[model samples]
Target: MHWQGCDVAFLTQHGKQHLVGPPIEAALGCRILHTEGYDTDKLGTFTHELARPGSQMDAAREKARIGMALTGSSIGIASEGSFGPDPVGGFVPWNTEVLLWIDQKQDLEITGWAHGHAQSLQKPIQSLQELELFALEAKFPEHRLTMRPSHEDHPAIIKGIHNVPSLMEAFERCRSQSNNGLVYVENDLRAFCNPTRQNIIRNAASDLIQKLQSLCPACDAPGFWVDRRIPGLRCRVCGRKTRLPISEVWHCQICKMQEERAIHTKALADPARCDHCNP
Candidate 1:
């Protein structure tokens, strides 16, 4: 509990503090000082109004730094999320959440990651019936939706439509402004708007807590976790090395300490996965 009794600055406008603060404070005994002094939408937005610059990790780190700067606290935390197609099949929608912790006193930076299915969908609607159908699929009232005239990049966007009345109103507004008589409707990807994204952010916070509890054996620093994998497990049929991990390399960012632990699971790689055997 190195962070016990410490004040950690958290910057968020999407009500993420409620989701991430409780577990962290309960487990680490740190104070979460919520800050809204800066507008995070300037960094990036899901609605495509302000494009997010740099990588996901970069955005999280920048937020943490900004929070620390604003609150003048030594430690800071921030969360960032992204949506895309699932990695395995590249078909289903996917969401990835990242929670970053920056401790200036200890000169340490740690990140927690969680990803899963996302409730993200978009459609072009020409009628109220089409809009209602899209809302049903997007889980409206609970998940919320955003409407824009003509296309996705339309500046005349109406956000945070929860109830049927609001949804209908926003749809009509966008439709009236639409030159093509078509409105673009989508799930609002904001954490407060999307419950699924909120849960993923919570999971990411739990992951960050786990890593924070894991102390580096050599330097006693936090964030001791697997840094890389050593590949080349032998193929079962060919008895030749395949591009499968045989061991994992746990690392400490502080002292740059590393420990290679061999994997004991299935001694050989699947023949189907082996280049030599399958070739």
Candidate 2:
């Protein structure tokens, strides 16, 4: 309580602290306080019930503020994640996990994120064989499943399908309840349920740790780091610019100071990536 940034209030309903807290605690040497009073689902839910407003970072900030207010801690932490199809061409889905840190006394807000392939699989099931296939691909048992009568807006829904027999029962019951004789089975995206997402959150926490380790040279405030990347890497062959970062702009978190540093003077953009050469 004496140190302004030593205690962090973590806001989570689905056990995110367990996944992300260890790395942060190790990196910052701070006590992690999990807030139990806040309704995290009220902000938004994976089931699509309460539509989340604002950008992911905005939601994360709100969550952190709520936790700090409830716990009377100057430091607050929260995470927001989104799952969907891979931006690059791929059959499997992807997850973007973002971890946010807010230090009120230091006036610092830092975000770290990890994005890549995700194991969040979901599909409409009609047959036992199909269900088994889906489960196999989704890493069943390791990753829990959820069932609903339909994709959305169905009263009869079975959640937290962990075991084989329970999954079997839920599939049959939900399929029968569906108007189309089909059940929507999705990988439980909750942090407690999905190990893949848990790992992603851990990665994001590591990113935050790296960013927080840096202090502003001018003001000595934490979270002083790269603010922007300048892209104008010139091709070696024709000397035309390509959309690759040539310099990084560093800024102070507390003091209004900025410095731009050029990267790797010896390196040049390959002709393959140059728009004029490739196009």
Candidate 3:
């Protein structure tokens, strides 16, 4: 009955385990039971119809819980993603992905993540010209998009648009539903639709593999890793404390054991990162 003897449960209905599951299996050297049939959109959706409740991490945890409940497995895994303007490139897209691992008997919960560049697009349109622009900008036909009248909850919302004919048809239909004649178009941020997001999910899986394989120095638990950061590296020029990580605090998810070690090769922060030195 215990899932410990068996493989881990990875909850996904979107055929995502194929893209993100390889690292986990390769690292853990266990079978991955891909559990499905859960309507995770009820927890939250990127298209924003039902408005995902709580944090992104909460949604992922719930998914893992559901997978474990459905399959009677003690170990479960799940992932979630968020998209927005790129932090480094200004208007370009960025994805924040999280992969979570849960074990009931061991009472262990750990998260691995990736927060960086992604190919995502969103636009609000009033005309055919604008839609075409959005399509090109989003790298459409490849990435695809979803269309809705006023909101994601719009009854006439069209999703999974792949071709120009379908795009034109959906736009005309959705435009009619809107009072202002504008349709909201966004890259379908779902795993099944977007490769960029899937790539990020894979990176998150890799991150989890690192944590899962890492044994705690104290108790030899698998989930021992950096739990937090200690900021305030001294500025090289000004010698004032700068907001850069000076150390990594490693902790065990199960034992709650904590350890802190210096993260940087040098003790001082770069002048560019120092507020007083640069600003």
Candidate 4:
């Protein structure tokens, strides 16, 4: 059951197919079959208690295998998201999106990356008077809220509210349950709950299209993309080796062919990037 030309399986508990499925279909002539009731949560979950089983690549490939097993489809797709401190700077929040494409027929796999600042879509209100301002900021009812006691006496004292009356009720209820009598309200980050995250998904879908379209020079396999870089570029000023990429290593999954190509850029690394010079 191919849509454009290729048959692929889409494994998701969330309705992510609405965002990621189309790009593969359009770019690579693929059809996507949804794998329902596949307990991807068993592999890992967002909650702190359920630690993810492996590195990003391993998890993604496992998800693809699960999809393929469910539908007996040769091609599969999956997406993963990790939200935490910025890799570049530890302070700011960073939301990283990863998309994985697998072609069992060709034994090829490709991944796409996207991330940016998340607006959070949340703000707190301590008083009834602040409701107007909070509503204006959050666009309440359109974007719902989760309210809980700032300090919990009972772990079950949490509420998800949409309407103004319910919001006020939940806030007061949570405050009453807290020893400090304060409530914290924030946006729910579930895909359906957060529009910002959905936008990131769309952007990652686009990136996947580009990755699937790319072909390996050696094996002519789809998803031939850069895996990593060989560092030790020379400093422009000192001629000393610096910590910058000198060549890019591209690989083909099906043929296990790897090629290292010199970087196109001629600009040498600055002294600041040199460990000996800078340190």
Candidate 5:
């Protein structure tokens, strides 16, 4: 209970405090000082208006830093989310959420991550009927949408279309303004707009809570979790090593302590995963 009754700053404009704040407060007995003093959209936006400058981790760190500065708190937390194709299948849409916790008092930084299927969709529509179909597939109303004239990058964009009437209005307006009679529609990725992404953010918060609770055996500092996986699992058939991890390396950031623990799921990797045998 290192963080019991501690105050931490959290900066977000998309209502992420509701999704990320409670669990940490409940678990660590910390107070979440939510603030929207700065427009986080300036860092990056899902509508492509402003491109995120750095890597996902960098963005989250910057956000936490800003929150700490704004609230003048020693500790801060923030969450960032990205959407793309799933890594394994490369076909289904995927969402990855990262939650960063920075403790200036202890000079410790910990991150939590979660990834899963995302209800994200985009398409060009020429008529209201097509817009309806796309909305259905995009999980409209439940998950809000953004519309732009002609293409996704168009500057004339309408966002937060929650209901059918607003959706129709945005479609017609964009369609009329489009040079090619097409309106680009996509699921609004803001945490408040998209419930699917919100759920992923919640999971990321849960991960952060777990990491925060795992105290280091050496220094009694939090966030003593697996840092990396060692890959050298032997192939079951050929006895050759594969890319699969044979053990995990747990490290404590505060004390710089390390421990290697063997994975016991399977003694040998599958033959199909062996590079030499498969190739």
Candidate 6:
């Protein structure tokens, strides 16, 4: 077997293999082994009730590490996701998917990363009459909706309400118990429940596969990838220094060597972007 061809174990309980495994195998020319009955929720979950064990990066790394430890494979992979309003700046919802690739043989870790904006539904609804408006906006039945009382006094929160009958029951259930007599309805973004999220996961998997195919110029590591940014982009109009990334800092996880290359040519930001010039 090629050094990089060792099998990679994936730690997930949600059948993520349906979305994450095939492309990785094709790209890295390796096999994917899944850990059955592995409760990833112990590490963390989508619901805020169960706190994640660590930072997103840490959680992903540990998940991979545990898989490697259990399977006795030097290589392991895992994916983690964060969903909410845009992390940078936008009104739309965004999903950040992170894939961790770890090689214990070389003590190397590289991440395949992707982020995208998705049309997600999040609004409060008091009755079944209100769902019609949200259904149109969210494209209901295709994209599932979740529900919980607007004023949650107990742990029994309604989740994964897809159909109209189920949604009505959940809304009324919450309304009867809630002090506010309202329900918080939003999109159910679980990949299995939501098709839009599944597509994004597939896209992230493809990006990870591409990263595995890359080789570092410094040490020739198979998963050589970008780790940081070199900031200083010129604004397109004013030609002043703005805080945009000028280059991507690529590195070899095994060797710790670095390479910096500009993603584009502009060296400074336009005065329009500069606070001193614009403000």
Model 1: worst 10 consecutive residues (lDDT sum):
127-136
The lDDT values for all models are 0.93, 0.85, 0.82, 0.72, 0.93, 0.75
In candidate 6, where is summed lDDT lowest over 10 consecutive residues?
Answer: 147-156
**Residue 71 shift from truth in candidate 3, angstroms:** 0.7
Sorted by lDDT, highest first, which candidate order results? 1, 5, 2, 3, 6, 4
Cα lDDT tens digits, model 4, 1-279, are 222576688888767888877766777677788887588778775433257879767787888888989898888888887777777877766678888887766656677888976535444446766766766666566666666665422354343466878877887787677666456666555555557778898888888877777777776767777889999799877888876999999877777788888997867887888887787
Tens digit of per-residue lDDT, candidate 1, span 1-279: 798999999999989999999999999999999999999998999999999998898899999999999999999999999999999999999999999999998889999999999999999989888887888899888998999999999999899998988987888788889999999999999999999899899899999999999999998988999999999899989899988999999999899999999999998999998999787
List TM-scores for all candidates, in order: 0.97, 0.94, 0.89, 0.80, 0.98, 0.84
Highest TM-score against the true fold, candidate: 5
lDDT of 5: 0.93
- 2 versus 3: better lDDT goes to: 2
Please, what's the RMSD in Å of model 6? 2.9
Off by over 4 Å in 1: none
- Clash totals for all models, in order? 0, 0, 1, 0, 0, 9
Model 3 per-residue lDDT at 58: 87
Clashes of 5: 0
TM-score of 5: 0.98
Task: Report the lDDT tens digits of candidate 5 across residue range 1-279.
Answer: 898999999999889999988888999899999999999998899889999999899899999999999999999998999999999989999999999999998999998899999989999888778887898899988999999999889999999999989988888888889998888999999899999999999999999888999999999999999999999999999999899999999999999999999999998989999999998
In the range 1-279, model 6's lDDT, one tens digit per residue, is: 233466888887766787888777665678888985467778865645577867889999888988888787888888888887887676778888888888777776767777787646777777667867887788787887777776433456777777889877877787777667677777776666777777777887887777777788877777777889876776666665567788898877667788887786555576766765678
Query: Per-residue lDDT tens digits of candidate 3, residues 95-195?
Result: 99999999888888888898877767767789888888889888898887899896656666677898889999988888888987778888888888887
Q: What is the lDDT of residue 176 in candidate 3?
A: 80
Off by over 4 Å in 5: none
> What's the lDDT for candidate 2?
0.85
On the 0 to 100 scale, the lDDT of residue 58 in model 5 is 89
Residue 175 lDDT, candidate 4, scale 0-100: 67
| After superposition, candidate 3 runs with Cα above 4 Å error | 1-5, 86-92, 150-153
